[model samples]
Target: MNDPAIAVDGLTKQFRGGTRALDGLSLRVSRGGIYALLGPNGAGKTTLIRILATLLRPDGGTALVAGHDVVAEAGRVRQLIGLAGQFAAVDDHLTGRENITMIGRLYGLTRRAATSRAAEILTRIGLDTAADRQVKTYSGGMRRRIDLAASLIGRPQVLFLDEPTTGVDPASRHDLWSLVRDLAADGTTVLLTTQYLDEADQLADRIAVIDHGRLLTEGTATELKDRTGAAVVELDLPPHQLDAAMTALQPLAPRRDRDRILLPAPDGPLTLRHAMGLLDQADLTPTDIALHGPTLDDVFLALTRHNTSRSARSTA
Candidate 1:
């Protein structure tokens, strides 16, 4: 990653109905990296993407995409960026090649140039064999890839993906991930927004967690996980023993996820040992117990919980 490809500062947007979508949110994204934005529904992830893609204007503040002001030089910014929304945007009646070629023509390419470019991109995106088939016949993953291919017609310097994999199957999701990595490796700056924690953990070189249209935190996966806790002591037991085990470990302030009890191990091995000792003293025969590093899910939960609690207190 090098240089700020996207710069957003003091950005704010409010709807006519008095809904504040963005609250002075600001973040900078570097060139040639897979940057991910993680947040819940209505967190303003889409709003931010729309602003950067020149689809919507921010009510206040400044945003620069590809070194061009999003509001002032909208046309220039549009030329340097590509965007895919939450769902696939394609004509079901057209073939994959036709779709890409059409987008190319819209980008000012000649008919021949558009056709040649579309043929080349179809191969690159693994749709060459199915290029002639109507888009309605393609699978969900193929539709997504085609939509992404459409975005690449102009060779955009900045690509915005807002929930690109939503409602996609596991296999399709993996395919999309590989394409994103390849794009970044080829010097394309990608800005991805997804609710899938693993998507952010595996693909993003850096991640920004936003809430209420404001940035809560931004860093690498490891950095964000470190803010939660050092390790997790997970205990697995039978249904009957769950209550006893949790009650016995009450002093540790354990939390339950499904059938397992999760205890924050800030002291790492020391906490693990303490937990084991407590279980032993209580004569609880557990099915299994393990220690592992905190996961992205843990980090997300911890951050959101903290923010919600703070917001509640502020209101109180």
Candidate 2:
């Protein structure tokens, strides 16, 4: 295979007092694609990002960004990567254009080059109108866009975005998504870690789920959903009639929790039709019914739930 844009092998990190933040995590990201890492808080996503960004040292294992070892070649690796952290990192005292220009200068651009690049980036990020406004006067979303613009100053080969949309408004988040897509289309590799499942579903070419410092699974959204090998038929009925609905649908082996009954709908709408017929036979009328395939949320919940259950059993 061609060289991957990023590679990790047996990466491990342990904090003080024996908190294993990452354990033997390994993965490869192809060039020019968006790879998303999904995990609950404390699942080592940030740790991995920091390591790859050359901001943190790993206790064991190796990570290479743009073919430079993150540990041994930290300086070279840093030159090839851009990082937009979980929070905006712009200086509140500086104007938007000044912030980006400063970053360009830091990357060794000449004074004239930095100023020109700053103007280009400000326009690109749709912040040209706010170019002279102090960053403190910008809204949260505007600040985020400025921060992202700063990261692109060096034209990095690999970009790491750690929850880049976390407090952003819906409109700004949409803009950021478009920016990421444009970057990938231009052959920049992007690694994103986000709390939003829908964001991953919409933007990621591939996604990896992590828990307890280990990888649970990784694949495209459709592939991950298909691995579940089942669609769901959800029935919403009156609370008083839920039991009746579940009983009537028992032949379909429905699972009930609270007011909803979910059954495996292997035959898609045919299964929903059959379920409706059973409910009608029992004189039960569903307030709502729908048939849908497994979603990324379903895949995440199932994988994490299984991991938690296995951990419990092992401890017991």
Candidate 3:
């Protein structure tokens, strides 16, 4: 089998104030696939990314990027990876082309090579038309694409994106997503941290959810959803009928909120039909009814809920 593009084993880190940022985290990412890290704020996603990118040292264990130890072969690892952080890092005073050229030069390209590469990247990222405009004049999404273009100056084998689309408009975000897919298709392994669950659902070949410095779960989106083991049947009824609908759906252990009742539907359509029949028998008509498979949002909520519950119990 081929070596993983990135690997972590029992990785750990802690801050000066005793905040444990990572606790025995372990995972492997294969070559040519997008691996997304999902977590709430301060879940150590950034810390882990920084460590893997060789920007910060881990307190314990080890991390390898492209088969080189991050700590020992920091220089080699730097050469193998590209990092586009949460914020665009381009100099606002420089034009988009100049910014990319400067990065290429910094990566040790000749002046001519840097200029050529910069033009190539600007064209690739669809910023050629605005390439000569100062970064400050670019829209939020344009800045992001330019920053990403700079990261590719060295044509890295592995790329790390930290919240790559946090505040971009929807259209730009879609474009960035397409760019990422194209990069992975061309065999640049990607590791990204995202707050948007749907982004991870759409882009990641595999996802790892983390909370409180620990890995909560990891799997392909479908596999993670399957782990929830039941679809959700949502019923929208008149507010006055909520109580009656809840009682009728009692066997499914329905949860109620406002005018909607949500219940597990292990048998999917069969269970949905039974639920509607029960409501019919009770002379309660639903305004709307839908059956939805478990979503990434559901998986995230369940895993994070477990973390919260466990923390509360430990504190108690």
Candidate 4:
């Protein structure tokens, strides 16, 4: 098989306290696309990102970035990779332009070249108007944009973003999304670690879900959602009518949870009709109704629940 931009096999990491942070985690990311690494807190997402960025050493197994082994060719991997960690680590006193230029200089650019490159990147990130202002004076979004520009000083082949938009506002999040998409379109392979399911749904061509130090599943958003079966109809009936709705729905649908009525439906029209008909017969009136397909939430819940149950049974 041809080499992927990033690949890992049996990757394991144990911290100083002997806690297993990553256990046999393996993943593959093809070239020139966006791949979202998803997991809840303490699921080894950050550990894996640190290992891939050469910031932390894995105790066992191997990881490759841009076809270079992370252990043996750590320097080479660093040369071809750009990493933006979860925190915005920009020097607060430094202007946005100065920050990016400093990064360019660190990457071996001459003073003049670094200045020019910083200007170009600042413009690209839409921070040109604020380029000369101290980063401390910028909003959270501006700081993040500057940090992103700093990471791209050398136009790296592989970029690793660890929760890049964690504290950003909605508008800033949208800007970051556009920037990431443009980067992928320009053929930069992007690996993004995010807990936000909607971020993965909108940006990633494929997503890998991990939890409890293990990789659970990976596929396109739609493909992963499909694993859970079909669309769900959630009926928020009044508290008093909940029992009636549940009873009426359970017989006609695949599942019902509390006040929610879930049906394995291909489309909404027919399912809506049947559900309304049943409600009428049962003399039920719901306060709210929602139609939801197999969403990222469903996918995450299904995979993690399966893994948790399996682990529980094994320990028993």
TM-score of each: 0.92, 0.88, 0.88, 0.86
Least accurate 10 contiguous residues by lDDT in model 4: 307-316
Which lDDT values do the candidates have, in the order given?
0.89, 0.90, 0.90, 0.86
lDDT of 3 by residue, 173-247 (tens): 999999999999999999999999999999999999998778888999999999977888889999999998889
TM-score of 4: 0.86
196-305 in candidate 2: lDDT tens per residue?
99999999999999987789899999999999878999999999998888889988988785788888788889999999999989999999888888888778877887
As a whole number from 0 to 100, the lDDT of residue 103 in candidate 2 is: 86
Candidate 3: lDDT of 137?
A: 98
lDDT for position 274 in model 2? 96
Q: Candidate 1: misplaced stretches above 4 Å?
A: 1-3, 277-283, 313-316
| Candidate 2, position 156, lDDT | 91
Clashing residue pairs for model 4: none
Worst 10 residues of 3 by lDDT: 307-316
Q: What's model 1's TM-score?
A: 0.92
Model 3 lDDT on a 0 to 1 scale: 0.90
RMSD (CA, Å), candidate 2 to true, equals 3.0
* Candidates ranked by lDDT: 3, 2, 1, 4
Global lDDT of model 4: 0.86
The worst-scoring run of ten residues by lDDT in candidate 2 lies at 307-316
